[model samples]
Target: MKIEACAILAALLFHSLSVSAQQGETAAAAGFSKDIAPILTKKCVACHGPEKSKGRFRLDTFEFLMKGGESKSASVVPGQPAQSELFRRLTARDEDDRMPQKDDPLPAAQISLIEQWINAGAKFDGPDPKAPLVTLIPRAPHPEPPSSYHHPVPILALAFNPDGTELAAGGYHEITIWNPNEGTLLRRIKNVAQRTHSLDYSPDGALLAAAGGSPGQWGEVAVFNPTNGARVRVLGSMPDTALTVSFSPDGSRLAVGGADNSLRVYDVPAGKEQLVIQQHADWVMSIAWSGDGTRLASASRDRTARVYDAKTGDLETSYTGHQGPVFAVAFSGDGQRVYSAGRDKKIHVWDAKEGKEAGQIGGFDDDIFKLLVSGNWILSCSADKKIRQHSADKRELLRTLAGHNDWVYSLAVDGKSKRLASGSYDGEVRVWNLEDGQSLAAFIAAPGYPAAGETVRASTRE
Candidate 1:
């Protein structure tokens, strides 16, 4: 009886091992060009590519793969999938030392594909001109990210739909679309190649205008079809770095501001420069055209915010109240009131038509980098890392959102839903459900950010 039992056990073990090997065969049948190339493109190429050969490794070709890097050994041994150094790095947890060194770890399915490919002896017919490594084209370069919090991309600008159903976040190299309620990233707009600075959606939500590029180097102000991120119009280019952009309320015109200290207007579809409102004495850091598009308000390091006539290219008002450089400007819904903030550590509201001080709200201890006014409240974020919500009518401090450990530089408002979005200098963007004064979501730009002394230490309700 004992002999019979041993024979049965040995047969069962042999069958199981055969099944495992066959599973690997199925994956190998999918092949290197089809199954493995994608993993290399998304996860391996960044560190081991032509532009940056970190560790002296290049995974672009099978020859490069077999030659390995400075470690002086093949990263993958044919038929020994379990002993591959490439696989080890892929599974490593130390972000600074890990392969790819950008976002989250590769998916299990992707890692499995490599294991099966190696177990099949890592055989390849090499690159084929006719085949060209066809892959399932992802909808966009970044596609739908699994999580914004852990992504390597840092958010530079964000805007919301009028109905407040969607939030659009522009990143260093991509844009993250999210569900405001769930704070989940839905899609990424990846058409622009460089780190983006400022962006705004059209009134109807059909178009998006984005600006800012290589620091000190101005980039293209592109009008994109937000649904698919197809460039509808290369509206214009800034000869000098532009910091902010705004779409006219009617969507017929675009206003861009930057270091050239000019606010240039371009006719949207025609992509022609309509008029250059180059009157500011310092970098025009902010631009906002009133509801009728007749007046353009600009804030700058010139220690003042000016309102210009869109048609005549004339400065209509030099509204100055703050003692320091003004950094942000916004017009109220009706265009009757303007809010400007700056290093003065106070927000100055002005009568748009009269160009006189309407009210002054002060309390922030640092430069006020950005501001957004919604309903009856003015939400301001400053270098001190405090988000202050003030009574728009009374200009009184209602609440200070204190939690971030760094300076806040950008603000987005969902008018209908009362949601406030803030992007910070420390490389993080967060959404607040203003109804209850609670944070809805925060997307950290890059990992290892907020190094000592540079982070915002504001405290707010979660």
Candidate 2:
């Protein structure tokens, strides 16, 4: 009887071992590229992929996955699926502890495949063996200004010097400085960027900062001498396109917003990054520094605006009332209030000190692209091809300056001169007298480049 029992026990043990072996083989057959990469691209890449990295975690490549993130440990534990943070987060019961926050949890089958891959030693089979493991560097040369015969190029960004003597309009690889009073081009600051998205003058009017990049490739922020257009300092480059740049009240630092969904502050004199604030879930569209320069406000395509401590990079508050992508943000003269506008066709005002909604202005027929706060007025330009002026303290529509035949892309206000500059997609730049709501000067910025259609007559209303 004892011999028979021993044989049965041995047989049972052999059967168990065979099943375990089969399971291991199945796990080993799960390919990293074929099975695992797709799941990550679809489910994880939105937050951890290129353009943005939440929690400092990036899972776009096998190397990045192994390097881990802020936790500073391998997210995947080879041969130990149960112990892996990657698998654990996917299966976490608590929503807060889950891998993809605010998104639907991965289906069970997808989770199983990831677990199997990790259990099988997490080997990688890259798409190309010779491909570089890092993100591709931008190789495209900076664009040059179009020849005189070429069509008028759209102006996307505009700014005024503190003294209101000059206006800076962003062009392809150049910043065109104009005499706002004479309605003539002064000089072209050349070879700055391939596409300029934002421009700002230092508070003291000594420097002009240009922000832009080769979309989907790289981004740059360059400071230049406004007097001679000499390149002063190239702050640095980013992995994605930068859309907005603003100088601090004292001009000692700069705040930059970019497609990477981050707000970075750089020290001007030291030429080094001082702080990186990552909170927005989508592209950061605009950034504004307070009058005191202690607080910074940023708007994002994530449908929210946020205020951050400029010095510490800490998030002070977030304004979430905008229903669409927030594209423009500005702080009032005293830095006590914040204003933001976006695709939702509404302007939201917030108390900077309390982080509470103060007021809202809505009536635009299209997306508002840029905003300027001049004294008690809030001026905005829109895709509707018009520039609208509003009372800052009240929800009153002051006037609408309509002249652009295409989308209005940028706006700049010179309070000292009482002039408002508006740039449009058709390459027209119109300067308006705020006091009388009259078109003071009008000209085609890039003369021959009329964007999508033939050049229209400039509005020269007195």
Candidate 3:
């Protein structure tokens, strides 16, 4: 979401957990309200609870068990006692001592009782998961009219502010800010200009810069106060509608990409054009700054992506392999890699400094629009209507999320939890808990918020 025409993203808190064994019915419930708490407390809690926390294992509650031991696998499934890992470890064939280490396993009758409880679906009632985690209900930035989906708006871009407090998005010349948790719009920074095209927040979160223009024509960029939405200064104008904008890591300068096949850099405080590079042979599709602010990567419609030295405005190198226009580009945290996705239906990983093609990513049937890198994972959205997670190094597809019904246009990452938010051409923004592909929020905007009953979700692949 963009605040005051500059891109500022709201920090989102994600909720989810990845489970195994295909999510069987009641594996975790192997011991129920009447059966399990006491068993664990009597046999396990002493060594595992807060005081000792032996093996970094704590089993005072179901959530603790769900967040099993250091091995990181499900210990007690809610259903399916047969596959419950705890059962296997306890009933080990070698009985030198299976459970309790020195003592024998729980008596046979007690074990049977536990099995029965698990089969019933581990219905937990001990306490709410957030009792210890004070959940802060975010103040609503966008008002809820009995329903937020009643009226929907076309969305184009989204970004989180440097400090992670605000979100900004543009498309209808309108920017909406959300608390990121309460799902409330903190403020709506309105822009009356023709479709707003680009947004970026200064490194300090005090200044915001937005760039856009009449479609097909050169555009303009503006700077504003992030907290008040007051206009600060005009960054300058573009030769064509801009595609993306970025603030240098130090927040000293702003870069803009345009349809005229060029990238321009602007000095922020002075509000003057610092350099213009006629690099891409076609419309520049995307641009990203390395973490250190020394380099910038650009993806373009010419089926190529290139690196530039930010200081000299000189061409560094061009990496090409896309069979189609490159739509998106991003630099890794350490600035070692550049990830680009495009119309060719593939993602190409390139070494930023050397501009060498590092690896090729495939598994989609359509163009890729946006790409973001986090640690060893690359999160991407595609024309395939899917947001996927992949191993940045191994070139392995990790998960393919199937919720969007239209082309995904933008993507954001939860810097802390590694979750994702995807906005699509379909007028819906879906938040996914990338850890398990959990669909936490379904934000749908239409001309008028539709009745709840009118909402429809695509059938998940069985």
Candidate 4:
């Protein structure tokens, strides 16, 4: 009787131990949504995503990932990492047989996690198997900007408030507003992306919109209150950085273009996506709205400039004469023509309706970076370290502002104050007198980096 009782207790202890071990393995398994999805989406989805699928293989979703593209063999076999083709390809030694062909191999830690997941039964932990990997990933907050600068950051975007009292320049992970005339840093708005690529203020001056993001990871459009430097809302998010943003003439809509090759428009007050245009094959480098707000035009790296019907999001016309990647675009005041500039190094004017080249302005020393239409003048900045103003109607060069020491990447104009601001690759911001092109005040937009004669205060909190 004593022996039988002891045997029964031993059996129960063994069963309890087995159950605990199983639970531990289940908890230790790698999660599809949290761990595996980010790796595949960043490394593999560019080729095997909705836009293009090579070898009929796609890893955008859990269901499709296990479906095994074109191959009769299983892509991922539960409980067996050695038998899984996906795991084998990831661990393959030969360059030709390895996954993510041209790119660098996945880090060993990531590979080990994937192998552990497959060995633990490759289970689906998310709510849905067909959901896209992009949706499964949560939005992570951007890192805080440096309290003090060790080096000056390049300024890629600049803007003036509607009343022209302040100038805003893009800094690393923040936007710094400066007193335009005195060259004093007025305020710094934080929580921006790694880079702010474009900036624009609403027609009424109530809101300021900045478009930018981490280069290949995330994109965002943030709207802020110009008076207090408070972030009012975020307009859009994408898979890559948002390159440029433009507010409609009436301040009712905002159009954003990005490296993802899509044009997105959002209703200002509602903060809802109104239209998404994906006609461009490469980055939509620049975007502009017509005077009447009925049409939109975009310049792209695919060597094309396109006009679209704003209301219906339909292609109106495509201008293909640039023959190189076009970087900047602007609509004529009358909305009858579009002026675009690019690596071709000439500003081309084309009829918006006919898509035929109307005229061209030459003599630019290098690639043009940005174009702005203020009053009767068309302002352009280029890699040649010059800013040129031209007659909007005649397409003739009127004035040239030449003092920048590096490629001028951005331009902003305010007719009320007769002021123009330009940012360059050398981290300099030059504010000029719009009437005579005289340098009004120039300073490095970088906070904490004092210029030759002036000291700048570094403030990242406000």
lDDT scores in order? 0.73, 0.83, 0.70, 0.87
The weakest ten consecutive residues by lDDT in model 2 span: 129-138
The candidate maximizing lDDT is 4
Ranking by lDDT: 4, 2, 1, 3
How well is each residue in 355-387 modelled by candidate 1, as lDDT tens digits? 899778877888888777677888888878768
The TM-score values for the models, in the order shown, are 0.63, 0.71, 0.63, 0.85
lDDT of 4: 0.87
C-alpha lDDT of residue 354 in model 2: 69
Which window of 10 residues has the lowest lDDT sum in candidate 1? 130-139
Judge candidate 1 against the unseen true structure and give its global Cα lDDT, from 0 to 1.
Answer: 0.73
For every model shown, the clashing-pair count is 11, 5, 40, 0
Tens digits of per-residue lDDT for model 3, 313-365: 89998898788899999998788888898998888888887888888888898
Model 3 alpha-carbon drift over 4 Å, by segment? 1-153, 163-165, 445-462
- Give per-residue CA lDDT, model 2, range 78-137, as digits (tens): 899887778888899999999888998998888888888887788877654222222223
Give the CA lDDT, 0 to 100, for residue 303 in model 3. 91
RMSD of each: 14.5, 12.8, 27.3, 5.2
**Rank by TM-score (best first):** 4, 2, 3, 1
